[model samples]
Target: MAFTFDGPLLLVGAGKMGGALLEGLIAQGLDAGRVRVQDPAPPADIAALLARHGIAAEASVADLTGPPGVIVVAVKPQVMDAVFPPVARLAGARTLVVSIAAGRTLKSFEAHLPAGAAVVRAMPNTPAAIGQGMTVCVPNAHATPAQRQLCEALMSAVGEVAWVEDEASMDAVTAVSGSGPAYVFLLTEALEKAALAAGLDAALARRLARSTVSGAGALLAESALDAAVLRHNVTSPGGTTAAALAVLMADGRFERLLKEAVLAGEGRSRELAK
Candidate 1:
């Protein structure tokens, strides 16, 4: 759905993910003049983009004038306490506050903001820097339907967005999509290393691994088939792919390892939330 906010939009950070969302919003025709960004040291690209588009950006939140319709907090989780007070001042009862800060809960935000302020707690991954992000958001009880939609629209600027009715699921969501990219990258690294050990040239192996992963991702995006189906289609019984799968899937090793990894991530997220 198209998203355009008539009132001011305040972005509390202009780092990688924040910059990506800013780029996406402008590309989707959100008026630059109505957007204000707060970042102490924005990357060169973000600074240039804001300047080119006539958007206002400052190092301090005090520079912004707001009762902003939307306030997106993209700061690091560790510094959220410092960030929220200034942000809270900009939030009216109708304001929708969407946060991409990992491990920060909706209730944590509500505690700092005005009574009954609408808030959405979101987890978006590093892939968001390139606009391939997957964001899962959960709204607090105070958030209205329209506020939730606005949060979804704002996040959709960078990549795909999904809403969760149960906030408890957010820990698992963080483990999955929020940390999923690193797992994919680790797989690529392992594949490249194995190829090199098999006598392939280092550069060639790296290139092949990169291409294979990216190409498979593209195919997955364009195909309607489930991933298991796609894997089956590529594997002929007793063939090379099947042989490789046999080792990877032996005694459910692969699935078990992934489950463990996700649990570790989820545990870490919960720990940080405290």
Candidate 2:
């Protein structure tokens, strides 16, 4: 379902992810005039976009006059304590609060808002900046069906959206999709280094590594086959691909290393939530 706010939409931050969401909302045909943004010092580019779109921008939530229909919290987790109290004043019975801050729980938001306020906790990766994000949202009991649908639709403006029944699983979600982009980027860096080691020019190595990773990602997105199936398709028995796989797959080294990395990330997320 398409999402449009019934009243003014207040954006608590206009940093990278928040700015990206604003761009997506405008691209999806939401009226910029109905949006209000509060950021102490927005980046020059973001300020320009807000001016061009005629979105109301303020230095603080205290400058906002009326209650907003939707309150999107995009500030860093560290600053949420300072940001929540002032914004909570804007939460009426119908206000739907959607937070994209990692490691912050719905209960934490509810504690700061009015009793029974609808809250949705979401985790979106850095890819969201380019409209290719994968977001997972979980709503509290106070969130109605319509509110949940609205959250999904709003999130889909950036990319894929999934709903989770168990909030505890969010740490795993954080480990995977939330931190997943960095893993891909690291892989790209490693591939470039490997290419350089193989005598390729630095510029050529970077270009090839980037293109290969991006092209492979696009192929995975467009294809219905499983990733394992795609990998098998690329491998011919006793060939160069198989030779490389022998090392990567030997003693399940790669798999074990990845699992360890994910566990470490999950642990960190849990610590931050506390």
Candidate 3:
């Protein structure tokens, strides 16, 4: 589906994640004319981007000749309550409120909006900057099927999109894809450290760690085989990969630790909802 800029799109934040979405949307044929930024102090880069696109930025949501078709809530969760009332005013019957703020729920949006407000809660990871994002969204009952399509279209500008019927699943989604990138980075750091300890030069170790992880990820994404199958394929009998797997997978140590980490993240997400 083509994601035409059926704006005026009210983007409430101009931070890194939000800026990435705006840039991606533009690259995918969204018209900058219909976009506005509500950030009071966007970073210099984002301010320049807004100017380059000829999109207006304001301290508040304002001056649109018409009500916004979509109000993308990209502000931090802590500031959501303060931000919603003004947004509520601009969200007409035709409006679709799509929020990317972590831990902010549909019900929270409902409480601040007019009756029968349509809302979607979405979580997108940092990889969205490079158009490799993974976003999971859940819609309130009031959202129309057309609105869902629009949501999917806009999100697809950044990367892949998935939907879930259960909003509760967001906690796990937040734990996994939302925080998962940091885990991958940590793995890269560990690999680099290990390579250094193994007597490789710092620059070479860094290159090996980053390139190997990124290359493997690209392969995994493009491959038809599942990750386990790919892992097995790479492991020749008694080879280096097998030797490494033995230490990493011994007694399911890696799996257990990863599970624990994800669970802890999920628990924190749940707590934030409160």
lDDT of each: 0.86, 0.90, 0.90
After best superposition, candidate 2 residue 132: deviation in angstroms?
A: 0.7
TM-score per candidate: 0.95, 0.97, 0.97
The weakest ten consecutive residues by lDDT in model 1 span 57-66
Root-mean-square deviation per candidate = 1.4, 1.2, 1.2
Candidate 1, residues 4-109, lDDT tens digits: the string is 4556888998878888888888887787777888887788888888889887678776645558888889888788888778778877767888888888888888
Give the number of colliding residue pairs in candidate 3.
0
Q: Native-vs-model 3 lDDT?
A: 0.90
Misplaced by over 4 Å in model 3 are 4-7
lDDT of 3 by residue, 69-174 (tens): 8999898988887877777888787789999999988998898888998899999999999999999999999988999999999898899999999999999999
Candidate number that wins on TM-score, 1 or 3: 3
Global lDDT of model 1: 0.86
Q: Clash totals for all models, in order?
A: 0, 0, 0
Cα lDDT of candidate 2 equals: 0.90
